[model samples]
Target: MSSGMQRYTRRTLAREILLILAGLGWLFPLYLLLLTSLKPDSQIFSAPTDLPTSLDVGNYAEAWSSADLGRALFNSMVITGGSVALLIVVGSLSAYTIARRPGRWSAVFYLLFVVGIIVPSQLGLIPLYSMMRSLGLVGSYVGIILLYGGLWIPMAVFLYTGFIRAMPKDYEEAALIDGATPFRTFWRVIFPQLRSVTATVATLCGILVWNDFFTPLIFLSGTDKVPLPLAIYEFVGSVATRWNLVFAGILVALLPVLILFVVAQRQLMRGFSGGIKS
Candidate 1:
């Protein structure tokens, strides 16, 4: 092999090694969490650093029952699923309109959304809570769904708009010439092209909604309505600073997202790459 090629190969190997080490560094805590969750409570305190000598699945059973984690998981799924669905539909429609029409007022409308992104959600939490209360939606599933959807809109819209704008106009123009109505053209022709961006948006929004604690904590009053994150918070509180149970609950809570990432990782990477290419 040429000297230059040999040097390039060595650099590539070094980079891969560095990346592997970094990935393991990030996963170290999660590995510890998983081990702790499988350990008996007695073993948790006694052999904190050591793996369980005997496998015990009882801790998972205990954790699941101790905090209505099952219900919390269900609630989390509903909220995150609803939020992603709404964001995709509404955000895509809004993006298509902005990209195709570009009316005199389009810039103003887009600017408003851009400004919304800059405004922190915490700044409006108090007023938002009062509004939800007045609407008689406190502790309701609809309430949380709407809040999550609304809060995520700005960023979702921004991504959709950029993706839509990058699409070629010829496709829509040809559909128009072929007697397809505007709505039909958008739905059938252009919308399918948006799959990559939509996937990226869904993955991002799912992660955010799944892990969110503040919204559920503040808006949900009943135990049954709380999502996994807030349920885990309650779990920790009940344990009175028992790190074992806390870590166990956190591991349980993280499992869904980890599974999601593992399943959708390829699609997620492709979507991001496609978006950047466009």
Candidate 2:
């Protein structure tokens, strides 16, 4: 027993050290970006990894004005929010149906959607661009929101399916016997129990849509339609390589995801673990 305990202790110590190192490695990029944002432009390139001598917030102010962040933030927020909302409705409903129905055709339908995850979005870029152009939906918020909705649906559906599968059918049956219609049963009873998985879906899909640059770059050429990622790209180009300002813009761009993670991290973790276990 003593030998076994010693071995376990050694293993746990090693694991903790490895995890700490990995955590630091993952945070290095963010640290560098913040460091750059605080440094003077002369010091930015001189020693990129050196700690900033002072916390100068002027870079953030410059980024805000020069990047037209007001419009960009609004566009990104609207698109990301709309896309996540659509995914929650469509993905959850489809997943619930697939879970409760449970037949060969349902399996096939789920397979068809799950298989989409294997197909890289870049592969469909040209066709997607052409489709938007043909439909006269290019450079519009609704078009990009719809595009994100379709692209994000598969993962959300997959998550919701797994989570819904784990749910007790007794509650659903009880609701049915209580004279609650199928739709009402879902909204009133089933959907409320899905808080964890739904939060996970919303956060994951929101972050993806928020960070996406290429889709907007291809479909949205107008300044007003451009999201934060594209706005930052254009700002960098116009600034003639002022990396201090660039880092500031990136930091600002990361704020929403950071805030969301800080607030909903517990829910996100529960969602993923509960989903996988179910």
Candidate 3:
């Protein structure tokens, strides 16, 4: 090979090796977690680096029964699903309007939601909890659904707006010329085109809502109302004696996200690419 080509090849090889090492570093903890979870407690600590001599799945059974995870998983799905649904409706509409129409008033409205990206939800916990309580929404799925919806809508709006802003208005204009109302034009023409951003928003906010611990802890304390994260919290406290079980529960909790990432893996990345492909 030419001298310059040889240098480029060497550099690519070095970069690949470095990335492989980093990937291993990130995955090693997960490897350890699975390893520890499978080992019997007697062997967990004793054989820290060694592979489990035997796989014990009793820990999973104990985690499920002891922690009431099945119900919690269902609740999480509902809250997450509801939040994403609300976000899609409100965020997509708002973003499409803002993207298609540019004005001082529109700018102000857009800015209002954009600012929410930085406002930490922790800061509003006090009044937010009070409002939910006043509305008799405490310990209710709808209440947390609204909370997640409200908190995440701003982020979704931001993403959708950025994405929609890049689109040609020709499709919308053509739909309008065909005598469709604005909402119909948006629903049939514009919204359909926003699938990439919608998927991205759903994935992003779904993960947030599903993994959230603080919201459920504060807004809903009933054992039946709690989601997976809170159930895991209770699992840790109640099953402290069973480290293997705790780790097993933790591993179970990670499965949804892992599955989501695997399933939407490509589309999720594309969504963030702003629907712009080379």
Instruction: For candidate 1, write residues 1-278 as lDDT tens digits.
Output: 99999999999999999999999999988888877777765676765568877767776777788988999889998889998999988888887787777887877777887898899898999999999999988888888888888898887777778778787889889999999999999999998998878888899889999999888888984648789899988887787745666777788899889988897888777666655432
Off by over 4 Å in 2: none
* Candidate achieving higher lDDT, 1 or 3: 3
What overall lDDT, based on C-alpha atoms, would model 2 receive against the true structure? 0.89
After superposition, candidate 1 runs with Cα above 4 Å error: 273-278
In order, what lDDT does every prediction score? 0.83, 0.89, 0.86
User: Per-residue CA lDDT of candidate 3, range 219-255, in tens?
Assistant: 8876488889999998888866667888888888889
Give every collision pair in model 3: none
Task: Name the top lDDT candidate.
Answer: 2
Q: How many Å off is the CA of 80 in candidate 2? A: 0.5
Model 3 spans with C-alpha error above 4 angstroms: 275-278
Q: State every prediction's TM-score relative to the real structure.
A: 0.92, 0.95, 0.95
lDDT of 2 at 219: 88
Global local distance difference test of model 3: 0.86
